[model samples]
Target: MAEGFLTTHVLDTARGIPAQGVKITLYRISGMSHRKIAEAVTNADGRTDAPILPKGTFRPGTYELVFHAGDYLRASGQAGDGVLFLDEVPIRFGMAEDTHYHVPLLLSPFGYSTYRGS
Candidate 1:
């Protein structure tokens, strides 16, 4: 284990702008167990700037990245006052070894997608 870990970015696909003020929550899961690990707010450039996981925090298991899409789209004036297709988007995946996880969100008002990155 190292001293720190993890990072992320958020891109507003519809508006072609950096998604600021988006809430990102990280979770650690193993078997039937889950726990909140960390949280961060995207910066002006749609990135956390600093590391998401602190040093010596690496662990091999499942993880979840929950992005507050609806709130951000509304704040950015890209979405109207209605039920959104993407409210709180949860991305669940597994980590087999100690490595850096760059989970990025490409979000739009109608749809969204995510992928594991370097």
Candidate 2:
């Protein structure tokens, strides 16, 4: 695919593995209004089967990726009542046209981090 697209991957930092079957939701953000765009579950490689925002669909604006971390961890047998700190992890970023946006998340039950990738 060309440069103007949005993609993501998730890694389970604690288990040192790709976080499969994690529910991810994409949203277009406009001030206080959040509109859902798309939703997908991570595959075996912790990536969506297709780009979140394909080339023709990409636009310059703010977007959010909400990762259902707690549920994924619980399903993987990693999270418990008091041990889970993060549940729905939201990564918000601004995209520019004609540029590839790869937002990868390194996550644990208690903490997570993300960055803009090539």
Task: Write candidate 1's Cα lDDT for 1-118 as tens digits.
Answer: 4633678899998889889999998889877887998899999999986766655887777888899888998888877898887889999888676667777999998888888888
Can you give the lDDT of residue 108 in candidate 2?
A: 88
lDDT string, candidate 2, 1-118, tens digits? 4458899999999999999999999999999999999899999999999998777787789999999998998999888766577889999999866788899999988789998887
Candidate 2: regions farther than 4 A off? 1-3, 81-83
| Model 2: residue 24 alpha-carbon error in angstroms | 0.4
State candidate 1's TM-score. Answer: 0.90
Pairs of residues at least 3 apart in sequence or in different chains that clash in candidate 1:
2-56, 3-54, 3-55, 3-56, 4-54, 4-55, 5-53
- lDDT of all the models against the reference? 0.84, 0.90
Question: Candidate 2 has what TM-score?
Answer: 0.92
lDDT of 1: 0.84
Instruction: Give the winner by TM-score.
Output: 2
CA error at residue 87 for candidate 2, angstroms: 0.5
